[model samples]
Target: MSPLVHSGPRAPLRWAACTCSRDPAFVVDPAVQLVFKHQGGYATLERVEDGGTSAHEKNEPRFRPYDGRVHGVLYRVTREDFEKLAKREGGYVVQELQVQTYDDSQYNALVFVSNPLFKLPQEVIPTEKYLARVREGARDNYLDPAYQAFLSGINTVPGAGLGSEYYNTPSKYMGYSFLVIAALITLAFFFQH
Candidate 1:
């Protein structure tokens, strides 16, 4: 069976947006020798606000070559589901890595990592809402207790959920453009009356 490793928000069945089977094949360890670095912030696609576009930076799970290991849940997926997953995870690069389950069993699974070219210069703290999803996934999957604690301890930018005050604010020029368009429409309406 083909397998996929989910170490982040997608670890929880609830947060998993993929159409794969709801149940995990098994929880596994050594998903990779790579260190789990949750700090890397990447720019999501541009969000439009007030007729202007702004790209929001958000923290996402990524792995790097380090001395530690990443533990995660392994899921059995069909070829169609795997293709859908690959499409959904367009921002990430996929690699096949070996993972071991609790019974010391091993399977080759596909793991996703943020593309290095898209990584931000400095780390951005994840939002509380985002962290909650990650926490829920780890808890739901019964990941390593120490790893769960470490995940819990990571600080978040309070109230930084999407479209919150922390996200893209319309530029002054966009604001002005909106006002000008409104005024123009109002003038046109009056002239037609």
Candidate 2:
């Protein structure tokens, strides 16, 4: 009889955001890190600035200009993990909040754990191949070769090197060229006299 092998299903995690009011006004800056833990491991949290409008809708009772919300980054984790993290310290109950006027605002929150409805592909092509394809596509689309060359030159320039300093420091070469020109001019003047 052949031995049986089983692989457990992957967990589903939805990126979410939460907003709460602080009695003492707090300065929320962009790029703050948030962390969440699960049975398997902990996932890093990402904070995105809530734009001009508040997270809640204007008509909603919870809506407040002073209130702030932290946006989460996209990731995949299990529902059980999410619940466990939510119940632990620093976990806030996911709730739906609305914001008016901002059409691109994300409102829905994860109220309960559920099965992952989507799965992302696992295999990724090598970086070199991917970039080569981008370059090929640009060539196919009739991108300007001169512009591409200019970008390549800019990217190729090293910040610091013997050759780079020799080329970049025009003052050194300019002074030498000026001296040669002055000597040639002086010789011509003497011959003319």
The C-alpha local distance difference test score for the whole of candidate 1 amounts to 0.50
lDDT of 1 at 17: 57
Per-residue lDDT over 85-192 for candidate 1, one digit per residue giving the tens place of the 0 to 100 score: 677664467766666765676787777765544433334556766667667777777776766676667666664443322222234346678899999999999999
What lDDT does the true structure give each of the candidates? Answer: 0.50, 0.30
TM-score of each: 0.52, 0.18
lDDT by residue (tens digit), candidate 2, 98-150: 22212243333343211111111111111333234334433443334542342
Q: After superposition, how far is residue 159 of candidate 1 from its true place, in Å?
A: 5.1
Error of 2 at 46 (Å): 17
Which is the leading candidate under lDDT? 1
lDDT of 2 at 58: 25
